[model samples]
Target: MKPAILFSFTIFISAFLLFFVQPLAGRMLLPTFGGSAIVWNASMMFFQALLLLGYIYAHFSIKRLGAKNQSKLHIALMIAAAVFLPLSIAPEAPQWDASPALFVIQTLLVSIGLPFFVLSASAPMLQSWYFSSDAPDAEDPYWLYVASNIGSLLALLTYPFLIEPFLSINEQKWVWTGGYALLVLSVFGASFFVKKAPAAEVTATAQTSSSWAERGLWTLLAFVPSSALLGYTAHITTDISAIPLFWVVPLALYMLSFVIVFARRQWIPSSVWVWLAFAALVPSAYAILLALLEPVGLLLGIQLFSLFTLSVAFHAILVDRKPSASNLTDFYVWMSVGGMLGGVFNTLVAPAIFDRMYELPITLALAFLLLSMHLPRPKFEPPSVSIGKAVRAKGMQTAFSVLVLATAAVGFVTYMQSVDEVFEFTNTMLLIGILTPFALWFVHPILAGFAAATVCMVLPMGYQHQNILMQMRSPYAIHEVREFSSSVGQFHSLYHGRIQHGVQATHPELSRLPLSYYHTSSPIGEVMAIREDFYDVTPVAVLGLGIGTMATYVRPGMEMTFFEIDPQIEKIARDAEYFTYLERCGEQCKVVLGDARLSLQEQPKGKYGLLVLDAYSSDAVPVHLLSKEAIELYMSLLRPGGYMLFHVSNRYVNVRQIVVNTAAELGYVSYFQDHWPRETKLEELMVNSSEWVMVGRNKKDLELQIFDPRWEEQEPDGRPAWTDDWANLWVYMAW
Candidate 1:
């Protein structure tokens, strides 16, 4: 095969392994940690950081060892990494009490440690090999980059549609192992080719390489857009379900950008479209803000639109910085480095730096600046007097200028209207129509772009009839205020991603009562009802308060406490008057606001008879709280035989096994009961949801619960239980 073709094949296998492993590992961990945004972010950060380390290693290896020796060393490493293949570090049951973030990182390192290190270096390493050993006539190795991203894109797209639904966790792992073996063979074959060709002299000039200042620009260009895309994804999926599938859309768009930027095609025309995309960003971003303020539509429109803008900007910048084919692999190494920086900043650093989503606006602004810098300067002359020619020029300029001014004026007017104020639909539609022509015009492109952004920022039309619910930017999430008119009692809603994760009714009577999963009608609620007879339960600890659903189940005498990760959900329930669950319950409800697992560890022992885990539904399971160690924590606080109820009704994974398996090992017997509330006459009143309560008693009972078919029967494989030291997500995909 030609060097270029071989190079493409190498990049292809490398990328497949890179992305295929992400969701595979994530699924493994999902059952243990209650699905929270932090788990996803933490996992991504680990991947990026590890990839960076791999590239840095490859860069130095090539500089020091030359081609033949480097290939031999790479092949040996791949074989070593294969020994650890079928990546399985986090056991089905985990042992230690580690934060979800630490657990995810440690798990990734051990499972794919050597393999990922090899995969990360594959693109750069292969491109270097092609350069040293292959014919000079071969096409620049940079085209391999296009192939690598194509493979990455394919893997991302395949997971949601193909792999995830068809294959179990174990199957995915074995398949990945097969791919790794193929990769090892491919690299070894390429190595044979590397040695056969005559060795070329290593020039000091090539060895020394470029300066950081030159490289940093490429890094910044890559990092900013990459980070912005993730931030946008997070903001959209914050309250709703962040199913693994949702990740594909943004990542595909991101990869496609590489194709456009790196391909030989001239991108000036493509950029024209991107410039127009900026205008749409404003409207889309405005829609998102509206959703954040009050849970309205899925924010699907906003997410798709913002991703489009972000993708355009990202691709445009990359197009401007296309590396020569000879340096293609090296260029991508820098790009990946930039991506790692962005992930670290967005996932690891920024969340610590700023409590809320202040970084979101900053990312948007940066995208705008990057796009503006690369916009092609128009070649048109200044307006001049040449009779007919002048008239035509002036007409075009005037029409475009007037349209921009009108759009800006409308945007300003829209912003002036308070969120509570109502407007007619027709007026809002007219405002958007008038702005479109101006936003599309190329005259003063940046100014036009700004006008378009303004249109997005001020959503005058979409908000016309929508009720404004409570809106606040909490440390962990955005809280929304909701309202409903006389016909159907209004509801205050808390949303994360597309799902209405939490809902509270406007009726004062229901406001103080936890109505959703925690209602008395559910199996867990039934357990809470008779808890007084079991023991003297002083402090009743609740992990998640979805519209204060479980608060209604609390008895009058016991002190009720709620541990909520998102303060937005809490504020919407308490202040919006959407649901009166908290008020109706009437006990001074003390909300221990933070991660439930973290908060539980800080509290006094022997707190209550019942501990509820309702946070997993409406979101991916939080891997941290579901681990075997977390179950032990709940057992520690409970009096002997004090039962624990877990609500596990998920659309994706079957969580019953994890609970049954973990509970059994910890010496608790559990039983399963399915609760489905009857359909009511009021359509708004009929919210259909299910809960599976796993009741486990003390040490003797915990064992029985594991074997009880009524609850769930799944055994721990005796692997290291998820501890602070290590946890891999690949093991629990079956659950």
Candidate 2:
């Protein structure tokens, strides 16, 4: 093969494996970590940190040992890394309530750190080697970066659409190992194409190392998009589902930006890039900062467009400052450092400080300011002109300044009086806060950026403060207790993001009644009543203790255990200020703090007569809990004639299909109901339409004629089952 082909092929494969591991690692950690999106963020931090270390090694090695010897050293390292292949996380992993971010970093380091480090160095390392090759185009080796990112893009896309839907996690690991082995051989073979003389040639021709200022600017450029990637990802995943497909799409687009900006041709004009970025940024900022839009499809589109445009704009500017091939490793080192810092800021810092999803808007505003500085400024010519014209210009400028200040004042007042309703005075504030800055860009780009940042910061605080009785932030998700009124009387609702988890009435008698997804007339409520009446189902197990609403289901004599993932949720459930469900259950209810899967395993086999899986109804469902392996695990813990319940109330995903399909695949009799409260007006009480599926081993165990009007028996529909190995949630996405 030609030197270019060999080098490009080697870098491409390395990049492929590099990005492939991220989603795979996330999938592995989902069940253990309670399927919180924080696992992905922490894993990203570790990946970026390792990537930085790899670039540092490449920078020093290429400078000291030169390309020939560096290739030999890298090859040996790759061979050594293969010993850790056929990847699997340690069995001795942390419990669900253990410091999640630290645990993620620790497990990833022990499992795949060395292989990932070796792979991370390949792009910069091989590009340097190719520069030392005698190919005609070797002088400009930057084209290889485009090839590398293309491989990364394809690898990310392949995981969800091709690999994940087909291969089991176990199978994918072996495939990754084989690819790693082949990557080492490919790199070793490619080294033979490097010309010995060109090492001296590059040394002689290369420019001096980039200045400190240039390095600082490169790092700043990289940090914005890196932070936004996590911020936007966490935002969307919270509302829809925190599966691999959602994770992959943003990163794939982030990679695609590098490919577009680094390629030989510029598809978008340089002058238009900043404006394009600002255009996308304003709406996205508004959507997040103000609760202006609630539709998942619309918000997903706006934010994704903004993330892509901002990435492209920032990268295009960064590419213009690229050093020669000799300094490329140094350039990448700073970029990696910036990206690592971004992850640190989101995973470590933001949750500690900000109580809401503020990071995305902050990142967007900062990026807009950076992009604005790049615009071609209008030349102010103080030429000879009529005095009257100058006076008129000054008068118009004064009028504009007055108008801007007046608009800002009205916005502040409107926001201060804003209610939780979207269009009730909030939309007026959204227009003033978001669109004003956007329109001002034509007049003064820098001023618009400043206005944007101000809007991003000041607007959300006022908006979020309204009617929020209690709020808490955790690494996993933000929890809110807000007061709501219904015909049933005064009540307080618990929320995780925009999704209502549970509701409790303040009235003494009404407090014991299950509300929200678990209301008395809902599907889950029907299951509890039937189980209590029909079977001697003692010691029920309920996964996902949202506000401990299911604690109300424990009858006087029987005991129930609630498996909750976030300790923060546990704390609030126990607090008398917001709820009294756990207080009411007393000795009849026990709570376990950790992932449901791990905690469930600690229970003896055939331990429970009733096990209710209630985690799916959240804004984001735990996909790992819905797989075939998960079903089997639940079955193991159920008694001979025990029953299982699956709550699948969701707007964006058809989780009901997944449960119905998986249970049927295991040859179990199941009952499903998408319960809508129609006979009685739904608004009369604190209730929501819910969908639940009940599965049991014996048909006789599940046959309940009293609730036949609501519950329908499930039959196998021939849809492929989702196993621990192959789960394609996107195929079932409601979009």
Candidate 3:
């Protein structure tokens, strides 16, 4: 094969493995963690940081060892990395050792670390080698990146729709291993065709060294999009299920940006990208701020388009600022540095700085702010028309000033009025629309962008409805407390990822009452009531403590061990200001903080008579906690004839069949209730809809009289059980 084809083929395979392994490995590890959205964040951080390290290694390797020897050395390293492959977690790896984030990073490093480091290094390393080669076009190897990102985009796009649906995790691992072997062979074979220039001569032939300022710009440009990728993906998987598909989409778009910008044709003029980014970013910022992220089509379309456009816009700018082939390694080093830092910011810093999903707006603003410095000055006007141009510009500036103030004034008006009465007027888009037109009118990219961001940021300050009382964000998920008042009285409700977790009445008489999905007549409620005698005598283990709502069921003598993944949830629940379920549980509530599955394993076997899986809300259900293996683990923890209750209340996924099927196939009796309450007392209680499943060894264990007629016996379905090996969530998703 020709050198181009030979090099491209090798780069493509390496890139494919690099991208493909991310979701596959994440999916493999999902069951180990609680499927918290943070897994994706932590995993992204690991990948980006590793990729950055790989780039630095490649840069220094080429500079020190020369291109030819570096490739020869890399071939040996790739072979060594293969020994760690056919990737599966080592059994001895500690689960939740120290911290879950540290565990994920450590586990990933040991499982696929060396291979991934070598593979991730390939794009830059190979590109540098290609630049050194004697091929006719070797002088410029930047186009090879298009090939790399194309392979990356291919892996991302296909993983969910093709690979994930068909292959079991073990099978996927083996396939990836096979692919890695092929990549090693391909790279080794390509060495014959790729002849690098002498190290001294190659260095002398290339362009001048880039200054720190240029490198800093490169880092900033790369940083915004890298951060945006994680920020957007985090928002997606947090609100939607943390399934691989949602993760794949944003990442695929992210890869596509690299492909577009690196391709020979600048798909569009860089000058125009600023305008296009503005159009995309503003609407997206509006949706995120107003909490209008419906799982349905249009809003998602807007947000996704924004993610793609911003990534492309910022990356195109980065590409345009690239130095010659000599600085190629240095260029990529800075870029990956920015990318790594972006992951760090999203995964670490933003959680501490903001208490809501401000990622979309923050990233959008940063992109524009970074781009503003690079905006090309309009071609100098002829002296003859300079006066006319000056007047026109001033008029536009005046218009920009008036429109901005008007937008701010309108927001102030909304803030001044009774929020209940004027809530509809507080649309984020409407206020942005007022100023956006002036931004289009001869405005400087920096000033207009900052003004737009300012308006958007302030507009949300007046973004009040009658209900929501407080919002807090953690790396795992966003927790919201909303207040609702009616003819009867007032109640404060807690929500995570927009799904109501628990609620408590402010009224002193009704404050202790369970509401929403945990209503007394509800399935989990019925389980708590019917099995109270057993539970009071036997300790109860709650897998998910959503604002500690299930803590209400713990009797004075009964020990309820609440296994919660997020400390934020415990904080809100324990605080008297929120729902106060844990506060109400008082000494009866014992909280075990970590992944519920891992935490549950540390508990004494057969100590609990009742296992309540109240973790599933309408949003962000952790599938691992419901698998066949998970069920067995739960059963082992329960005393003989103990019951496991699942709160499978979800708006998007139909989790019943999978959960019930897996349980029944395990030789367990299962019953379920679709407890969607239609009738309730008007003045006192609010019972939101819920779904529940109960499983135990015998029907008698789950068929207690306290379980009203709402519960029905679950008949077995011949469908395959969802094991940790092969759980295809797409088959069960209602979407």
The candidate scoring highest on TM-score is: 3
Error of 3 at 489 (Å): 1.3
Error of 1 at 154 (Å): 3.4
Model 1, range 255-325, lDDT digits (tens) per residue?
A: 78676655656545667656655655655555544444344344666566667666766656665565544
Best-to-worst lDDT order: 2, 3, 1
Which portions of model 2 miss their true places by more than 4 Å? Answer: 28-42, 90-107, 196-204, 239-244, 294-299, 380-383, 386-399, 419-435, 438-444, 530-534, 618-620, 665-667, 703-709, 730-735
Candidate scoring better on TM-score of 1 and 3: 3
lDDT for each residue of candidate 3 in 1-735, tens digit (9 for 90 to 100)? 777888888889888888889878877787666566556677877888888889999999888888888888889998898889788875553554477678878888988899899988898888888877778988788999988988888887787678877888989998998998899888887766556663445555667779999999889888898888887787666654444357778888888888888887775887677667766777677566555656557766877788898888888888888988877999999998888778778778888897776665677667656655555544445567778788887787767766765765675566545466666665552665545634543455566566666755665566654577888787677788888876668988877655667778888888877787787777776566654545342588887777677777777677888888788888888879766777777887789877788777777888888888876664445668777898999999988778788877766677777778988788987787887676747225777877788788887765563256767888766767777777766777777
- Give the Cα error of residue 721 in candidate 1, in Å: 20
- Per-residue alpha-carbon lDDT of model 2 for 1-735, expressed as tens digits? 888888888889999999888788877766565455456667877887888899999989878888888888888998888888888887675644778778888999988999999999988888888888888988778889998999899897887788887788898898999999899889989888767543424555778878999999999998999899989888777744444346778888899899998887887875677678877888888677656446767777888898899888888888888988878788888988888888888888998898777787778778878877886655445689688887787567646754764675576666666535544564565466556765565466787777777777777766664667988888888889989786658888888767787889899998888877787778767667765556767888989888999888878798899998788888889999899999988989998876688778788999998898888755455677888888999999988888898887777788888888888888887878887777554555667888888888868877663357678887767678787657876777777
Best by lDDT: 2
Per-candidate TM equals 0.71, 0.90, 0.91
Model 1, position 469: C-alpha lDDT score: 47
Deviation in Å, model 2, residue 180 alpha carbon: 2.5
lDDT of 1: 0.63
Q: Report the poorest 10 consecutive residues by lDDT, candidate 2.
A: 195-204
In angstroms, how far off is 388's CA in candidate 2? 9.4
